[model samples]
Target: MKVNKKMKTSALAGAALLSLQALPASADQEYLLTITRPGHLQVIDMSTNEVVRTCDVPGKFGTGSIAPSPDGKIAYVLSNMTEDVYGFDIQTCDITFHAAQSQGNVRVKTHQSITVSADGKELYTVQNPVRHLPDRFEVMEPQLAVYNTADGTDAKPVRTFPVDRRITKIAATEKGEVILGGADIKAIDVNSGEVRMVTALQSWDRGPEWLPPDAFAMHSQGEQSNEYIMPYVTAKFQDDTMNMETAEWWWGISRVDLATGEAVRQEIIPFEFIVFNFISDPRDPNIFYGSFNTLSKHDITTGETLALYEMPHTYYDLNISADGKTIYVGGTSSDISIHSSDTLEKIGSIQLSGDMSTSDLRVATIRD
Candidate 1:
């Protein structure tokens, strides 16, 4: 059975409406962000830096990935639990409709990551079994599903691509290119619909849910003007090392050569445990930014570490405002952190209703 998940305004507070008369024009712009914690979606004001509102995402209907359509008219919330997608109107704060269902008998599992194309017409989601047997390490292979959004109805899955091993995380590039990062880094060809194995990580590896409490909580906070690098580490033993042990886990931002399935660049970052959830620059495709246990930025084009900032709280995910001038950081921290993209400064921060590490944030644009 399909269920609906919605948030109410009573749970939110309006922006403080403070004036920035002396500040630049860009400083006055505001952004509305939604984050998941337990059963609630905490809404934050990018300008005021406060938890102005809170909405309840139904407990049974878990929210996986959150994205806003191009024109900023509608937001898409993917629920792996219900095996469905919900569309919300930004201005009205209402559930408009559900995404078109997977077409031609294609099905989706719970907890899969979702992404929308740059043009905003296509929706890509990855599905993996929610539960797996522990006895045999037969990982749940992931399948990539695609959907069309024009009809404003249930999207039918157009493609079903598979992965060799279990996937830990997934991301999309500016040109609508898909890169899957985790224990192994892989890429998918959106045009040709081809999936290829790019590279296998040999260091710092771990299964899901390995992050410590402090790093996990700090990762939920997303402020501070700096870049970050985390070291990848895993257990070491004589027997484990002799048999090609699975000691290394992959973390941090990875740079890839899309034209050729090559993970041309990568770096081991600090914080042994923390899953990353954040956004990359659309304007500067090579400039990647993210936060988990810490905050960081990197330029793939120049192979340089731009900056790394340490956060007092853990940030689970990050989203950029429509213009990329503002950033909304969500996580378990008591406050919602906002940053200046240009100066990389923490301009404002507000307390939210729930802990950080909510859902993945997606920005979509609608254009005819």
Candidate 2:
């Protein structure tokens, strides 16, 4: 179904009013937040399956990574070709915070590494910087920049610590630590800035017969499950005589608990199809959903394919509702397709103005 563009302004004004009034104690509402190209932040009410507000973003869109506050009031967007981050009040569509990672001669980019703390007090991102010289460009070290949420529009990093390069996604844990995905999954203490390995990806000790696993974990959709999940592909020699014909390809998952920092990495099933992103069900821990050219539901514990449905097009990211009843898939196109989590059937869709590209699809729960 298509959203009415004429309701944009009026809906935003109504949302602002609702933000000021006290909501019912037991009333909880869920909304889907995402960005579209040439710059727009769209928020859709999950109950009615309609676009509520379309907030215009400040800079050029790139990856369009977003992190909503713990209370689900503000959405921090990584835009301006990943060189700048802006926080928008989803209720009023106001720019509440901004941070430009690029400086005089150096250009910085955060490749899908943006998140808010569990307490909603700080925002964190890993900045990969490069210095532009007269004749060439010099690659600089990466740093983890932290900013206070109360700093307002002209925000700056409160502190920064040197971190390993190639970090793509980050999530803050309840223990005041941030889990990072890179060559290996690592955890950094927010207060002490001490970095430690949570689990090994490329350096996994899966014996010399197995090759290093290849992982693509750019999407950040761990909020609903309260766990960071990454899907990986690897190969292993079938016998003592390592030969091309005697090898087996496999699919594995590396999951980290966002609340307790516990991590588990195991090969769930053999390599079957390409999956760009995966999210665990909040209601049922053993059930998980993945999206790409197809939508798949699997039982991670038994390596069983519970259901599979071919999608209309490829989707880069997918997220589930807090209740785990519905699934929202978007990224490649301008439409966010909704599906039934139980049956994997198409139920509805919300069409946007522009393509989402590599933008994130996030679910937010707020009081109404």
Residues 246-278, candidate 2, lDDT per residue (tens digit)?
688778888999989989998877678888888
In angstroms, how far off is 277's CA in candidate 2?
Answer: 0.6
In order of appearance, the predictions have TM-scores of: 0.58, 0.91
| TM value for model 2 | 0.91
Native-to-model Cα distance after best TM-score fit, residue 200 in candidate 2, in Å? 0.5
Clashes per candidate, residues 3 or more apart or on different chains: 54, 0
The residue pairs that clash in candidate 2, if any, are none
**What overall lDDT goes with each candidate model?**
0.51, 0.89
The residue-by-residue lDDT of candidate 1 on 75-153, one tens digit each, is 6665535366766665455666465343334444534355556566777666653333345433345677667766565
